[model samples]
Target chain A: MPYTSDKPPLPETPEQLRVRIPGWGVDLDPADRPAVPRERFDPGATGAHWEFPERQPEERPRERSIEHGTLPPVFGTTLPLRGVSGVVRRYAYRRFSEARAAHWLLLMAGDRIDVVESRVLAAVRGRPDDPVAETGVRSEVSHHGWSSRAGAGRADVVHQPMDPVIVAGPWVLGGLAAVVVARRLARRARRR
Target chain B: MRAMVYRGPYRVRVEEKPPPRIEHPNDAIVRVELAAICGSDLHLYHGLMPDTRVGTTFGHEFIGVVEQVGPSVERVQVGDRVMVPFNVYCGSCYYCARGLYANCHNVNPNATAVGGIYGYSHTCGGYDGGQAELVRVPFADVGPAPIPDWMDAEDAVLLTDAVATGYFGAQLGDIVEGDVVVVFGAGPVGLAAAQSAWLMGAGRVIVVDHLEYRLAKARELAHAETYNFAEHRDVVVLLKRVTDHLGADVAIDAVGAEADGSLLQHVTAAKLKLQGGSPVALNWAIDSVRKGGTVSVVGAYGPIFSAVKFGDAVNKGLTLRMNQCHVKRQWPRLFEHVRNGYLRPRDIVTHRFPLEDIAEAYHVFSAKLDGCIKPLVVPGPA
Candidate 1:
């Protein structure tokens, strides 16, 4: 690819940044919104939407090698969706996975941790309307978002919406810290 | 006088430009006699052409007189009236031998994988266009052919691009005898393709375009059955209804970015109006073709990669073919056709303007004003 010298102009202020890199469709005014508390982080929040994607039964699993990585689950000629989201969100966390012929890892991220968790939950809860598609959990992390390290094996995700956001970490801690500071300032203004 | 050079998207300048000198040993300088504004030329003006460096003159199609020739160039003498093939290619490349002159490696390395042409982009060897008063033709001995004594400069200009491309489209589409052909897009290329298809023995040549004037031109000048895509929403149904539901054997996309709005700033619409979203005639062509039919796309598309549902293509088993017209392969044959009176490529030249009034010409072409098909630009006698 040729080097791109043209870049769209960037936002200068935090308000502008928030408007641009919005997490989980959450509005900038978080005070009126339902916040996902840090303590409520659940690895199993994936619900019933989480199911191993239908794999072709005819193919045999490969033997593992220590030098390279673990062997992949070989399947018959069926091509599965790479991205399929959970049942509840229907098309939210588009989740689709296919067994790999080579080493690979599944990486997932949201604009923020809350958004990531919501996507994970959506992936777990298979869309009731379409039972054929389901999302499976390989691993979960709050701030790190979700990742499944299938030793040297590849997995493709379908319906995976790529959000343009450069987040530092989870939104819960950041939101809670801001809330505390705002309350203190309110108290000071009341005293004045 | 400064020559217009493309700086960036929508950016062009005519500064105190240096005189174009003969750069290579085989290069010959020709004072351009008649250079025309081509639809392909718009790709550069819009800054959509990738990697177009600054200081490149931006016209390709030309009819010129040989002012000077290199020591080794014995093919044409000075004052010889010639029409240079828009694409510059050495006569001795692998592709050139295979009659695929557009893909010549030495002239256009970037597009050599498929094929290359002139005044397009840097990937095509970064050769400056013929928009200026004088142009340097590299590989002069191989790239240019003399204009016949009977043919005028105005008539000869079309041989370089529109005529050649249209002829190529007809040949590539495999328009069989008595086959119904639908050419989508009514720009200069589309008009040329329609004429070529008619000449190549197609029983019916249906030209589809949204503009009424262009459709009128197709009917009046090219004698093609024209369809107003804007008024007629159902191209597939219409084609099927016209051809006993068998669709067309050959479908050519000559409109490219021009009539299809691919060259404009707007994203290509799924539907022309709000009726049903489909790529107008292209979709109809895809659906209207028989299972083993051929579809030739010579139109230029913009930056946005078009999303095509592959399922329809698979089921039809359609032989989709296209290439940037290899002027080297078809030019001689097309030139002969023109000479024989079988090909009337010059019929598409609806407007001509002086070099000083180029901006007005651009406005007309850009706005699709006054039934403009092909606008020829004469640089001198101002």
Candidate 2:
């Protein structure tokens, strides 16, 4: 997935994929594709000087999609893979082709995991994320939060009921856990 | 010839490279005089875009003297000082005929969405950019226009992309007279959008950004109200309060890919690559606009999924208009604006670097060092 030459093997053979998924290769036939006629395959027409442009030296490992034969000539080294989220991202790139939904879904999951990791790290550094302020809860009251949505017939109105729970569920759970721990510590202190 | 070569992300160097030659009948080779680094170029610099080859030179906004022309080329000749539009398109293409040169289907192999752009990734058609001594422009007759004798060279260079794109952003907003417009990201594009909003008869224009220096530049250059988003507890709420709790009549997103409002969004999209771009500014634009108002997006984003609050736009009945600016389409009006002294695109230029020192230039620009707003690249002797 990151800094490797060999192509990753697909989880399933093409034949297996074809049978497992319905209409998996629907656009494989040129006849079925409307734009096939206009899609010209002319490499020389681009007038590039080199067959394969010179590869940039990789100072560190970099992410490459499984679909690519090798890393692109240049890649970002700013954000290196790290932590549990990194492991999830690595698994996605290594195990799935970009064409697969799993690859993208895993990457999205990794992003969510990264948020948790960041929150934990921030908490450890004594700069815990403020859910009330960061989440824009204060804006709701001050900036016509309910009235704006009440009769507006918004598309997101369908999920408006769930937004608060989705936003504050984890924070509520964390607060409850802290309260329980504090109570337990108090009880033990009294017993001593 | 010397060109800026992408060694890797955050790594570029000025290297000796062969000068570009006309490959197509409509191609023209232009000796670059002035080129400006675009905010979008930072996408390539940070390796956010896919298929950005190492040796690719990243510049789209450039003006130069034509050195050679292909046999079939017309409307332009050698020795003419021309500013090439960032778009490379065949004039006769369906999109070009409709004045949508940015969507011209013939130039780029991946022509489902955008047309060819110089010095962008292979996804945009692997034509080298103008951040070099020379650049080969395809469909030269259609794209490059002679710079007016009275026009400043620096102004012409900025028009190639930045100014044009900004003007286009405001135009797309469809601003009505006395409309309040809020522009997110006070970079060159945002500044231009802010200024152009006034031209479009906007009553009030507010520019938003975290950087105090850029906010000051917005005030000085665009003559618009400025807000340091970092100072506000919630910029969107502040926008609502300032706009009389109805939100701005129009909101323009000039920040793309690497927007820095929400730490979570920046980490997820810009850092983690889970989404194509950080949608903070775009989301802010969508949120800060009044119900039934328009939102214009000129910020460059990758051709991938972004966690945009699309449902909010639909619910708010917002008109979301966006595209890569059809650069030439906006020029006729812009030229007049420049001539009338209503706009001065080059006022944003804060730094200039010779082709040899582009890496330092990029570093200074990318890191936002020295209050650098816009940096111009001089290919000739500096």
Candidate 3:
């Protein structure tokens, strides 16, 4: 269904779709559309030599949305699905329609997981993320952070209390986990 | 062939790639001469856009010489220099017939909302971008236009997307004579919008940005008032105070997803990916535009939920207009403006990088280092 010169058959006939979904073909009538005259189906005019484009060789498994019949002729192979986040994203694409909020929310959740994964990876590589500096907390202190908010009457103030938790919550949890791991290791060594 | 390849977020490198070939009868293989790093490409570079797979090249603004054309290609020929619009649309589709080429339903199978775009994510149709030695351009006859004889190549390249999109933004505002127009983000698009606002008979135009260097560019290039939001306590309040408690007649959000006004919005959207885009600038546009005024959005946001002030917009009776630019639609007037010396799209170019050094170029542009404003990538010897 992806990148074929031949138009794919509709999943449902127009009459069936119209009956099942309201406003399914509101723009189907050429009489009502101004561009209808130019929308003539003239394949000869297109000059496409092939029935479908040659598919680029897939170097690895790629994410294809469930709604699509196959992978596009050419797809990005650079960031193949890997780790836990990739599994979640793959599930999102495999199970949900693009129109569903669940599809996007799952992707967002995957992105958050990716952030944590990257941070943990960085720590393992001896370049731990500096939460205070990287989180813009330093800028908040130095760059008119309080004065700008005091009299500005900004709408974002309602969510101000949660800012710290949202920004610093992961770092705090990570620190606690590290301390717990270190203490357990120390106790085990003493028993040995 | 060599091209810029995406390794991951904040990681891109020049790598040897297979030279693109004619994929369809309407396709043409273009030997890229010049490509630009658009502000929106940063969205892909930052991993902000969904489905931005690694190994995908990220470029949309480019100009090149046609190396080979499919048999059916009539208008464009081999050896002709061409400037391709970022939009890949079948010109006969319903949307294209109405000159809304950006929304052409035929080109992209992935999304119904927008036509295919070069070098953007799979969402825009997974067409490879032009930041390479060679690019395969589909719908070649419809999308690639012969550069005017008198036009500079730099100008031609910029016109492909950045300049045209900016001009389109101003045109969308429908600026009347003596209208006070405010533009957010002094990137190439914002600068072009400010300049185009004047051409459309704006009485006054103002540009907002946190960078002093870009604000300086806005003043020198667009000849408009500039405001460093970093210097102001509240930029919206400042706009209201300057406008005598009313707001500008039109406000344009040229700054898309990664706007830096609010710490929360930036962290949540840019960092956490909870929202598709940070709506700080859009909210500012809604709040800063006078009641019943127009808020024109030329900024590119992902197809996801953004925390915009929709209720406020409805209450204020504002006309909100936005679209991916119909690039070729604005070319006639832009060509005239360029010939008349009313606009110079190439003056914004601050750095040029060869294809090999593109990694450094993206780093400089992304980090906003060395006062870099607009950077162009020059693919090697033809």
* lDDT digits (tens) for residues B236-281 of candidate 1: 7777767666677888877554234221112222111111112434
TM-score of chain A of each: 0.16, 0.58, 0.57
Ranking by TM-score: 3, 2, 1
Models 1 onward score TM values of: 0.62, 0.69, 0.75
Which parts of model 3 are misplaced by more than 4 Å?
A1-91, A105-192
Ranking by DockQ: 3, 2, 1
| DockQ of each candidate relative to the true complex | 0.01, 0.02, 0.05
For residues B1-382, write the lDDT of model 2, one tens digit per residue. 8998765455567767877765666678999999999999988776667545556788999999999997767678999999999987665544555567787665554224557889986556667898999888876767899999999999999999998889888878877656778999889999988888776666677999977778889888786788877777898899877776778888999999989878777766655556789999999999989889999999999766889999999999999988898887678777877887778988989888888777677766765655678999999878
Q: Assess chain B of each prediction and give its TM-score.
A: 0.89, 0.99, 0.98
Instruction: Give candidate 3's error at residue B100 in angstroms.
Output: 1.4
Candidate 1 ranges with C-alpha deviation above 4 Å: A1-192, B11-13, B109-116, B258-281, B302-304
**lDDT (Cα, 0-100) at B64 in candidate 1:** 85
Which scores higher on lDDT, 1 or 3?
Answer: 3
Q: Write the per-residue lDDT of candidate 3 for residues A75-146, one digit (tens) a residue.
A: 333345668978987888788877887877776566557666766775797866554433324434433456
lDDT score, residue B317, model 2?
A: 100
Off by over 4 Å in 2: A1-192
Specify the poorest-scoring 10-residue window by lDDT in model 2 chain A: A30-39
Give each prediction's root-mean-square deviation over alpha carbons: 26.3, 19.0, 13.1
